[model samples]
Structures are given as C-alpha cells and as structure tokens.
Target: MKSLAITVWGMMALPGCRPGEDGEGIALVRSLPLSDQQKLCLEKMVDTFLPDTDTLGAVQLNIHRFLDKLIANCYPEEEQKSFINGLDILEGKAQDLFSKSFGSLENLQRESVLLGLDNEENAEEKAFFDFSKEQVILAYTSSEYFLTNFTNYEMIPGGYDGCVDVPEVPFKV
Candidate 1:
C-alpha cells in the first residue's frame, strides 16, 4: 500500500519538482493553449487510453484537464506546441485510418489509433504521443477518486505512532 502511494507520487512528482510546491496538484490550472477541437479530441483520447473498468476512468477524473494544465505551467513552449500538435496528428491519423474524427471513434478503434501512434515513424510524433500518454496516466493514478476509493489513501493516513513500544517477538527460532 505504501509502495503504491509512493509510486503514484513518483509519477506526478518526477516530472516537475521545485521549491514551495507540493509536487501533487501542480496541474490545477488550464491555460487556453489548446483549440476546442483539440481539447474535445484529447478528452476522448484519454478516455480511450484508460476506459472505465472497475473504477472511474481518466475522463471521469478530468485527467485531460490535468495534462493540459501541467503542460501549460510546467512544460516549455515547444513541448506545449508538441502536445497540442500531437492532437492534430491523432486526428489526422484517425481520419486517414478510420475515416472518422478521433472523438467519434469506437473505443477499440480509438485505442488502436493511440497504440499505432506509439509506433509512428516520426520521432517527434512518437515523443509527443508518449509524453501525453504518460501525463494522462500520472494524472489518473494520482487523482482524488483513485487515491481515496481505489487505493484507500488518506490525506492524513490514520496510523499515527506517537509513542508506542513494540512487543517482543514470540516463538523466535
């Protein structure tokens, strides 16, 4: 359990760590750097990447917003452009391959589009997809819904040990 918490924290914190910041909650503000179509497609794309199974999925937790906010604040201008452009790349691919917009694709088709993007021949294209995918996953796993209900991670975890003595082990070999 502790390890899971650690892993989640690592995913969010590993990207951007600086003074006077908690590392988490870094993606709280969404600057208007993306177009409406891009945003809509992005929402659909993230939902496809992490569909609702036993728990609320990425879109339910607004992880696409998280990714956008993180990119706005933490990412360089070049990287931000790459991310937004990646959405266009995805849309183009969706049109070329499936004859549909990314937002309109069936779940499996959307998943295939993203998976295929990973194997794109262009390094920048692949990098953009990879970066966006990583951000979405980090945001989803570290989301409040995932933390509280799924992982049972309390904001102030309950097992406080102020002054407790450990009892001796019984039946030592």
Candidate 2:
C-alpha cells in the first residue's frame, strides 16, 4: 500500500520535474550570484573547518558545492545576500591579515581567520559564521561517506537480537 501511494505521488510529481531546454541540470547555477573566486574561497573555508584526516573531509564529499547550492536555493534573498557579504567579510579579513585572498592563505592562517569570525565588531559576521558552522557540520554528518563508513547507516533500521521469544500461538492467516 505504501508503494502504491508512492507510485501515485511520483507519477503526480513527474510532470512538474522536467529538465531544462539543453539537457542541463540546475540551470540556476548560472544565475547564482557567487563569482568563481568566491566559490573557491568557500571551498577553502569548508575545508579549513573539516580538514581531511584518516577519513575524507567535507570538501572531498563536495560539501562546499552543496553549501553553495543550499544557500542559493533554500535561503531567502536577504539571507543569501548576507551570506555572500559574509564571504566578502572573510576575504577582507584575509587581505587585512595576510595581504592576500582567503583561498591563498596557509592552512594555519585559514584556521586563524575562521576562528576569529565571531568578533564583537560585526553582528553579521557572527551570525554568518554560526550558521556556516552549523551547515558544515550538518552536511558532513549527513554525507554518504560519513554515514556508510563511520556511523554504519541502516537503511530500514533493524538490528539483530540474540534472544527472542516466539509467539505462543501461531494462527493461520
């Protein structure tokens, strides 16, 4: 019955989910406000937050791009602008500290820059950094690599039980 319902809903949703004109997906990518340098800075920022260890990092799982798309698609326009501005703010910090872009900073410098985002001088930077940390953690934990290897994801949620009492009476259906 659940499968039947899903099929019905899928069929209903199929028509509204058509692809773009030129066999493209997410044509909104071109429309996104971020420049290439900003995207690179974002990648560097997320990587700095979750550097590769024994396991792959957030950037390895494409969390940077996922974040970009998330902010572009899900956040309200006002929020999207704020986040972009936050990126600019970080860039400015990098320039002020290292005389270079955030993407050009060393790993330690990147770490320092990100760690200092919560200064009292700007409320926007604090809000943006907090939201960014939350989203990066959320994306990392939910990635397939983290789930399948680190936490042992269970698709249907079952476990083995050693001692199980059988039904006293088994009635015929």
Candidate lDDT values, in order: 0.84, 0.87
Q: Name the best candidate (by TM-score).
A: 2
**Model 1 agreement with the true structure over 48-123: per-residue lDDT tens digits:** 8898888788888888887877888888888788778889999999999999999899999998898898988989
Top candidate on lDDT is 2
Candidate 2 lDDT over residue span 1-173, tens digit each: 99999999999877656776876553544334888888889999999989998889988999998998888888889988998898999999999989999999999999899888965367888898899989999999988888888886977798889999987897799
TM-scores for candidates 1 onward, in order: 0.71, 0.75
What candidate 1 gets wrong by more than 4 Å, as runs, is 1-30, 158-173
